[model samples]
Target chain A: MTRLPGTAKTPGGLYAAPSLVWLSVFFLAPLAIIVAYSFLTPGALGGVEWSPTLDAYRAIANPTFGKVTVNTIIVAMGATAITMLIAIPCGYYMARSEHQNILLMLVMIPFWTNFLIRIYAWIAILGNEGFLNDLLLSLGLVDQSVRFLYNRGAVMLVLVYTYLPYAILPLYSTIDKFDFSLLEAARDLGASKMSAINRVLLPNIRGGVLTAFLFTFIPIFGAYAVPLLVGGTESYMLGNLIADELTKSRDWPLASAISMVITLVTTLGVLLLLRANGTSVLGGDDHEAAEPAGEADALGAAR
Target chain B: MEARKLIDISMNLPHCALRIEDGSDSVAGPVSATGNGLPRGRALQGGIMECGGAKKKTVKGSDVVIEHVRKSFGEFKALDDVSIDIRKGEFFSLLGPSGCGKTTLLRIIAGFEAPEGGSVLLDGQSVLPLPPDARRVNTVFQNYALFPHLSVFENVAFSLRLKRAPEAIVKARVSDYLALVELQAHASKKPSQLSGGQKQRVAIARALINEPSVLLLDEPLSALDAKLRQHMLIELDSIHDKIGITFIYVTHDQQEALSVSDRIAVMNSGAVLQIGTPQEIYEAPATDFVARFIGETNLYEADVTAVSGERVDLLTAEFGAIVVTATNPPPAGSRISWTIRPEKIRIGHTEPRAARDGINVVSGVVAEPIYSGFQSKFYVDTASGAQLKVIKQHADWSDEGPELAWKDDVWLSFSAEDAYIVEVRR
Candidate 1:
C-alpha cells in the first residue's frame, strides 16, 4: 500500500502528539487532581489536607444530597421535554422553509448578545412588575402582579429558552439533509398527510432528535446560573448544592466527591443515550445492523 | 415477448373491442403500431367481435384529459394553456429540454402540483379537486424518494399498510410486486445497499403496488449510467406492458422518448409544439423546433419559386434550385424552411447513374470525416461554399475500406421525398 504524506506510521502519531499533550495537561491532570482531592480530608483553611478519608463518600448518602439529585433530574427532563415540543416543529419549519438561511440567522441572533444579558432580559419580561404582568393588568386579565419569576416554573422556562437553539440547530441540520420527497412518496402511496409525516419524517430524523435531546439535557442537568438566579430555595438543584458545598460550607472534599458523582452519572447517561441511538461517544466501530428492506425501492414499486 | 403475450390476452378478452372503438384508436393503436406491429396483429385478430360485446368491463387504465391547464410560478409561466389527452394503457412521453415544463406537467398529473386554471380529468372524472392521496395516481419521483429508515418490504407495502390491509395480503402483494421487478432477493436490503438501477426498480415496484390507474414518472432513469439506463428503460417498458396502465413519462432525452413512448409531445418554453406517434414525430415533424429537437437534421431556408402537382421548387441562398415533394404544395413566392436528416443523404465518390429527375445531386469536397464505430459523418463543402452533413452506415465489418478522407471529392444525393417542409417559426 502506498503511504500517504503525513499519515505514514510514525508521523501520524507525531501529528497527534500536540493535541494528546494538550488534553493530558488540561483534562487528565485536572481530573487526576480532583480524584486525589476527593479522597483527602478537608483542611480547616479551605485547602486540601494530605490525610485520607472516606467521609466525603459517606456524606453522599445524605437525604439533602439525594433530594438535590432528584430535583436536578426532574428539572433537566422537564426542560428537555418542553424544548423538544417547541424545537421539532421550529426545526422542521426552518429546514423546509425557502428562507432557511434567514430563519437560521434569526434563531442564532440571540447568540450574538451576551448569554447573561439575554438571561437578564428574560428577568425583565418574567418578573413580578414585568411586561407580561403589565399587559395582563392593562387587559384586566389579572387583578395583580403574579409571581412569575424566582420559582421552579421560571427556572424550567428560562432553561428551555436558553437551550432552544441547541435543540433546533442539530435538528435543523438533520432535517435539512432529509429528502422531503419521502413524505411526498408516502402521501402518494395512499397515506394521509399526518400519517405520512409520522411514518416517514419522524423515523428518518430519530438521530437528530436524540442528539438535540442530549445536547440540551446534559447542560441543563449541570446548569448553575439559571437555577441560582430564577429558582427559589425550594428549587435548589445539584448545581446549587455543589456550589454551596464549595463556597458557603467550604468543604472541598465533599464538593469534589459530589462533582465526581455528577460527572459519573452524566457520563453514564450520555453513554446510554448514545448507545440507544446506535452511535459511539469514543469513535468505536458502529454496531447497528443494516436496516432491513429498502423502503424507498419497495415504496416506489408499490406506488 | 411478455408485452406481446399481454397484448394477446387483452385482445382476446370480450370487453377489449369496445375499448378500441371508444376513441382509444388515436392513442392506443399507434402505440402498438410503432412497437414491432405485434399489437396491431392482435388488435386486428380481435376485430371480429367489435360490434357486439355486451357489458363494458372497467378498463385497467385511466384516461387523463388535461384541458386548458395553466400554471405560473411568480412571474415565470411554467405551463401556458397546455392540454393533452393521454389514453389508457398508453406510454406517452413529454419530451423537452430542461425548464420546458415537462416535469411540471407530470407533477400536476400526480397531484403534487395544482394548475391555476382548467381541470384534469382521470377516467372521465375530474381529479383536480382531489388531494394526491385521494387520486388514483402515483408518481415515481426523479430521485426514487425511498425512505431511508424503512426496509424494502415496508417501502413497497407502505400504501397497503396505510389502507390497513391485512398483514398476509400486504406481504403477498409486496412480494409479488418485488418479484415483478426482479428484486425478491433484495427484499430485506436497505435502499442504500442497492445499485441505482435496483433502487429504480424498487421505486417502480412501490408505485405499481398501489395499483394506480395512471403512473407518472419524472425522469426516473436519468441518474443511471448509459448502459444501465438502457437496461432499465427496457424493464420500465415491460412493466408498463404487464400492468397495462397509462404511463405519463417525462424525459429530456429524445432517444429515450422515441424508444419507449407510444406518443410524444415536444415542448419548448412551456408550450407544446407538436404531439404525434414516435414515427410521425421523427419522419414528419410539424415545426422547426420539433424537427431540430427530435434528432439531427440539416435545415435550409428557401423561397418557393414554383409549385407543381406534388412537388415544390424552391430557391435557396446557397443551393440555387431545390425541388421537394409535398402533397399540398405551398403557394409560389412563399418563404419556407425544409429539413433533411443527415442519414437520408447518400455520400459516394462519383455521381450515380441511377439519378433521376426530382432527385437533387451536389458535388463537394469532404471538409471533415468523423468515423464512429457503426457510422461515419462527413461534412462536405459544396462549390457554393455551403457545408452539408451526410452520415453513411458501415454495413460490413472492416477496419478500413471505402474510406472518404478530408479534401476528397464526394457526391451527395437525396430524393425529393426525403426532404420535408417545416413551418418557419419567428
Candidate 2:
C-alpha cells in the first residue's frame, strides 16, 4: 500500500517514536542498567562487576533495611495524607473563588524558590532558637527552645510543605471543570450541605483526588533531600538507605536493589489504588469512575 | 427606588381595581383548600379563572407566596421587589426574555438565591430561614445537573438514600420514578450516556423521586431541539397532571408558557409587568412591553381624539383615525399606545364587505410578504405611509401560492375589539 507521509496506518507508534527513543536512551536504559546491577556482584570500587549474585536482595531482608522500608512507608503515607487534607480545601476554594488567578499564583509562588532553599527556610523556622523558638521565648511561652528539627516529624512536615502545590494544582483544575450545579441538585434532593459535598462533589472530583495522592505520595516515597536535611537517625528512610549504600558503603548493587524495591512498591501501590477505586490509570477522566455509587447506594438504603 | 415603587404601585393598582369593577365576585376569593389567599379572581379581561381539566388531583402541593422579594448583584438589580403568588397545584410560569429576572425569581423560590428583602412563605409558613435541603422544594436545573458519577437509578434514588430509606423502598421508588419519566430501561446507564431528552428525563426523575411539595423547573427544556422540546413539554405537563404538585416553571419561550401554564407572570427589566392566565396575557396585556413580549403584535402610539361608551377614536401619526375598544378609556386628546395582533388584521385585494358595523378598514399596499408553510405575514404600507402587519392562515389548499404577492394593493380590516389600548403613555 502506497501511504502518504504522516499518514501511516499505524502512525500512533510512529508519532510516539521520539518519546520512545528518548525514554530508551535516558530513562528505560538507566532503569535497565539499575535492574542488571541489582542482580550483579558489587565491585570493590563502588560499581557492579561481571559476576552475578543474589547478595543485594538478601541484604534487603536484613532487619535494619526492613526497619527503614517500614519507616519510609509510614512517612510517605503520612506526608501524602496531610498534604491531601490541606490541598483539597485549598483547591476547592481556588476553584470556587473569584480571585482564582491570585490564589493559583499564591499556590505556585513556592515553586519559584529553589526546593533546597525552601527546605532550608523551613529548618531556619523550626530549628533550635529558630523563628518559632525565638517567638516562644519572647512571649514567655517556653523557658527553653524546643528541638523541632532533626526528626521523622520534621521530614514529614517538610515533605508535605514541598509537595502541597503538586496536589493542589491537579485538584484545582479538575474541580474547576466540575459542574457545581450538581451540588445544588444534591441539596435540592434533601441532602444537607455537608452530605452534598461528600456524596456529589467528592465523588465527582475523585479523579483529581487520586491524581493529587499519587503526585504527592510517589515523590515523597523517594524523597531524598527532605530526609537528608531535616531527618535524624530515627528518621532514616528508604531514600536515605539507598544513598548510604551507594555513597558511604559503596554497595552499588545494594543501592540499585533498594531503588528497584522503591519502584516496585510505588507501581504496586498505584495499581492497588486504581483497582480499589475501579478506575483505569490512563482513563482517569473525572466522570469515568462510577464505583462510589455502591457506598451511596448503601447509604441511601440505610438512611 | 421610591419613584419606581410609586410607578409600580400605580401600574398594578388598576389591574386589581378593574377586576373588582367587573363584578366577577372573586375580588377577595375564599381561601383555597391549601389555605393560601391567592386572590383566585378573573383579574383581567379574557383571563381564565378555572384550573385545568379533569387530570388535576387534590391539592397536595405547597402554596408559594414570594412577597416584595428584592435582590441585586453589584450594580445590576436582578430582581426588584418581585412578588408572585403561585397557587397550590398550579402550573405557573415566570415568562420573560433573558436577563429579565424570571430565573432569578425561580431561584429565590427554590432557595438557591437569597433575596435582600422580602419573605417567601410555603403554606403560610416562612421558608426563608430554612436551607434548601430543609425546604420541601426541589429544582430541575436548566442543564439537568444530574450527577455524572451516579447511574440513572442511583441519581433517581439520591434523595431517598439521603433520608436512609429501606433498600427495597429505595429500589421500588427509584424504579417507579424512572418509569414515570420513561427511563426504566436505562437505569443502569450513566447520565453521560443518555440523549438530551433522556438526560432531562433522568433529572426529572431524580427531582420528582423526592416528592417535594413544590417543583421548580428552571428552563428545563431549553437545551433540547425544537421537536424534543415540544415532546418534553407534553411529558412535563403529563407528569404535572399525574403528580398534581405546584410547578413554578421559568422560561423565556412564550408559546411554551401559553400552552402549559394555568397562570403566567410576565416580567420585564427585573419587575413583573403583568400576571394572569395565558389568554389574559395574550389578549389584554397591561403594558406595551407585555404586548410586544407575549407574541408578535403591531404596536403604535396615537392621540386619543375622542372617547364614548366602549369605543375610543385614536388619531395615529401616519395611519390617520382608528377606532378601538377599551373598558376604561382615557381622557380625550391624551397620547396612548395600542396594539393589534397580526392575525387579527384581515388582508384582502379589495375592500372588506362583510361587516362594517364595528369594523375599521385601512387601504394599503403589501410592503413585505413572508410566507411560511402554515401562514403568510404581510407588512402592509397604508396610503398615509404607516405599516401594519396582517397574518393570513393557509389552512386550506387554495392558499398554496397566494395570489396577493409583494407590492400588491390590499385592504386590511379588524373589529374594534381586536385592537386594545396597550398603555396610556405619560
Candidate 3:
C-alpha cells in the first residue's frame, strides 16, 4: 500500500515500531517513574508519598553522598582508562590479523557465562586461599597467603573484566573499516612507526575510541554486582548506595533520586559521545579538534 | 607559478647544506639512522634541492638502479630477476598486464616490499636496507589513500608537522602545495567530501610536499573515468615538468604508458619482455606479445623462403607469400613471425598502379567494415583465406561513411618497411 506524503513525519517510523514500543514500555516508563519519585516525599515505610518535597535532592548534597560520588567516578574512570589501554592494541591486532574470526570469537566467549558467576570465578582466583595464593606458596614467593580479595582494587579489576568486551567490539569495528594505506602514507611522509599510529590511525578511529569509552564507562559507572561481590567496606559506589537506600533504609525517594543522578550523568555522556561521533561516523569532520595548540604555542614562544 | 618560485627559493639553502654534508661523508647522523649505511637525512636534504626548478634543472635528480631484484609469493613468482637503470629526472614506466610484476617492482623500489635477492641504489647509495619512512621516495597510491580524517591543508602539511616546522612555515608551504595542485579553494575540506579526481589531486599534493627524489606512481589515474583520466594524466605530466624529479610510473594501460613515459619497460608473467620508447615499442616490438599488447596489429607466422639485402620473403599456410624488411634477415627455410599495424596498410577500391620496389600488394574481399566516426576499420579476406586488417581515416567531409561496402573487391598494399620481424621460432 502507498503511504500519504504529508501524513507521516517519518515514513520509516513504521519499521521502527518494535524498538519504539520496547523502549517506551521497558525504559522510558521506568525512567519517568524514577524522575517523578525523585521529586516527591518518601512514605514512612517504603514507597514514595503523594506530597511533593525536595528532601531526596537535599540528601544528595550531604558530604557522605559526595564521598560515594567521588569514589564511583574514580573507579569508573580508572577502570575505563585501563580497559581502553588494553583494548586499543587488542582491537588493532584483531583488525589487521588474518585470523579475525577466531579472535572475535575469543573476545565474545566471556559473555557466554553468567555475570555473577564470572565475578565469583574472580573471587576463586584472587582469594586469600585461592589458586594464586596456592601457586605463590608452592613457588616460595610469599611466606603467607596474600589478601587479594575485598578491596577497592578488586572492585575496579572486576569492573574492567566485566566490561572489556564492550570496549573491544566497537574499537575492532572502527579499526577494521580504517584504510590502512593511510598508515603507509604517514610513514612515507617521514613519520616514525609510533608517530604514524598516534597521528593517523588514532585520530581516524576517534569515533570507535569514543564509542568504546562510553560503552565501558557507562556500564562500569552503574556497576552493582561486581562491587557487591568482590569489594570491601571502602568500595561503596552510587549503585550500592541506591541499593542500600531502597532495601536497608527503606527510602524509596532517595533511591530514585540516586538512580536519577546516575541516569542523568550517563545520558549526558551518551549525548556528548553522539555529538563527537555524528560527523566522524559519516567519515567527515572539521578535524580542528584534534590539532595541537600550535598557534597558541607559537604565540607563547614569541613572547 | 608562484608556488614554483616559492619552492625554488626555499629549496636552495637546504640543497647547499646537503652538498657540504655529503662531501664530509657523515653517515651516522641521528636523524638519518637506518639499517642502510647511507644517512637518510642527507638524502632527504638532497630531495629538498631537487624540488627547485632552475637549480635542479642543472643538479638533476637521483639515478635509481635496480640490480637483479627477485621476489616470489608462495609458488607464484611476482618479480623474477628484473633489473633496470633509470636515468636521473626521467619519467619512466613499467607497462604490463595485470599480475605482470609491474606493481611489485614499484613496491620494491618504494621499500614497501623486500626483494628475495637484490639491491636497490639511489644515486649510487644503497637504499634496500632503509625502511619506507627512511627512504627518500614517495608513492601516489593507486587508490589515492588520502587521510580521510584530515582536511586538504593538514594532509599536505603532514610531513612538515612531523619535522616540527614553524606554524607559519607549515601554513605557507601547505598553501603553496595546494595552489600547485589547484586545490586552494578546498583547503578546509576533508578527503571524503572531495570527488575522485579531487581526491587524486590531494594525494598528489600530499606526496609532492615531501619533495622526494623519486616519485613512484602506481596507476594513480586508474580510478578515474576515461575523460578525467586523460585530463589528470596531462596535469601529472605538467607537475612532473615543474618539479623535474625522477618519476617511476606503473600502469597496465599501454596508451597511458606510451603517452606519458619517457621510456617504458614492458613486462609479462614476471619477466621484462622489452624496454624502449613509445615509437620503438609500437613500430618494432621485440616479441609477438609486445606487438599484440601495444596496439592493434595483424601478425602472421610464416616460413622464410628467401633472404636478400634488407628484404626477406616468407610463405605462410593462410597467405600464399609475404615480403618484409628486416635489419638482420633470418636465413631461408626458417620459421618466423612478423607484424604490421592496420593503419600502416592502405586499402583502395580499384587497382591503382604497379607494385613499387618496396610495396607488397594483395587482392581481397571485404569481410567486415567497422565505421567508427573518424576512421573506418576493414577486415579483408584474401583469396588464400588469410584476413588482413586495414584502417582508412576520414580526413575530409567527402570521406564520411563506408566508401567500400561489404564483400567489395579491394586491393590492400603496404610497404616492406612497414612490417617487422617479431620472432624467429627455432
Clash totals for all candidate models: 29, 4, 0
**Stretches > 4 Å off in candidate 2:** A1-14, A279-303, B1-56, B395-402
Per-residue CA lDDT of candidate 3, range A91-157, in tens? 9999999999999999999999998899899999999988999999999999999988888999998
Model 2's CAPRI class is acceptable
Runs in model 1 deviating more than 4 A are A1-9, A37-54, A279-303, B1-59, B395-401, B424-426
Error of 2 at A51 (Å): 2.0
Candidate 1 local lDDT, residue A192: 84
Docking class of 1: acceptable
Judged by whole-model lDDT over C-alpha atoms, candidate 1 comes out at: 0.82
What are the models' TM-scores? 0.86, 0.88, 0.86
Better of 1 and 3 by DockQ: 1
Best by DockQ: 2
Query: Which 10 consecutive positions of candidate 2 chain B have the poorest summed lDDT?
Result: B35-44
Candidate 1 interface RMSD after superposing interface residues: 8.1
Error of 2 at A61 (Å): 1.6
Where does the lowest 10-residue lDDT sum fall in candidate 2 chain A?
A: A284-293
